[model samples]
Target: MSTAQATTTHDEIVATVTGIVAQELGVPAESLAPDADLRSVEGADSVKVLRMIAKVEREYDVELEDEQVFAVNSIDGVATVVLDTLAQDAA
Candidate 1:
C-alpha cells in the first residue's frame, strides 16, 4: 500500500473503532480516548466487548486471532491489530 493509503486506512480504522465503542457502550464518541480502558465504561462487559471486536473484524473484513483479540485492552491496541491485519491481508 502507498504511504498515503496506509495513513488513511489507519485513521479510518481508529475512527470506526471509536464509533463502535461509543455505540456499544452508550458513550459519546468524543469521549473515547485511545488510551481509555474499555472495561471502565458504563454498560461495558466482556460479552459486549467481544461483540464490538467481532463487529470491527466484520467491518474491516479482517479476522483477528483469538489470542490477539483477547489481549487487546485499549483502543490503541485494537487499532494496531486492525492495521496489522489489514497489512497482512494486503500482502
Candidate 2:
C-alpha cells in the first residue's frame, strides 16, 4: 500500500481498537489515545488487558501470539501488531 493508504488503514484500526478497549474496560472512548498506557488506566489489570487482547483478536479474526500481546504497552503498539498480522495474512 502507498504511504497514505497505510496511514489511513492504521488510523482506522486504531480507532476501532480504541473503541473496543473503551467498551470492554468501561472507560470513555475519548479517554483512550494511540499513545496511552493501557496498564496505567484505572481498573485495568493483567487479566483485563489479556481479555481486551482476546476481544481484539476475535474482532479482527487474527490470533496474536502471547509474547507480542504481552509486549504491547500502548494502543499504537496493538494497532501495529494487528495491522502487521492482517498484512501477513493477506500475503
Candidate 3:
C-alpha cells in the first residue's frame, strides 16, 4: 500500500483531517486548531460535517461508528477516533 494508504501517525491524521475539514468548510487548514470545534465554525452544518467524515473515511479506509462520528466536535477528536478505528481493524 502507498504511504498515504497505510496507517499513519496521529499528527499526520490530524493534518489530513484538518485539510479535509478546511476544504469542506471553505476555511484555511492552518486556521483550524487541533482542538477547534468544527460545529462552531462559520457555515458549518450537519451535511458538511457528514461530508467531511465521508472524506476522512475514504482517506483512511476506516469506517467509524455513527455515535462516534456525531460525537466528534474537534479535529483532535476525529483523529483520536480514526486512530481507534484503525487499531480495531489491525486487531
Q: Which candidate comes out best when scored by lDDT? A: 3
Number of backbone collisions per candidate: 0, 0, 0
Weakest ten-residue segment in model 1 by summed lDDT: 1-10
Of 2 and 3, the candidate ahead on TM-score is 3
TM-score of candidate 3 on Cα atoms, chains taken together: 0.91
Quickly count the clashes in candidate 1: 0
Model 1 residue 50 distance off true place after TM-score fit, in angstroms: 0.5
For candidate 3, what is the lDDT? 0.89
Per-residue lDDT of candidate 1, residues 13-89 (tens digit): 78889999999988999998987888888899999999999999877777899999888888888988989977887
Query: Each model's C-alpha lDDT?
Result: 0.85, 0.84, 0.89
The collision pairs in model 1 are none
In the predicted model 3, the residue pairs found to clash are none
Q: For each candidate in turn, give its C-alpha RMSD to the true structure in angstroms.
A: 2.7, 3.8, 1.6
lDDT of 2 by residue, 1-91 (tens): 3453344478888998898889878999898878989999878899988888988888777899988887889989999998998888666
lDDT of 3 by residue, 8-36 (tens): 88999999999999999999888999998
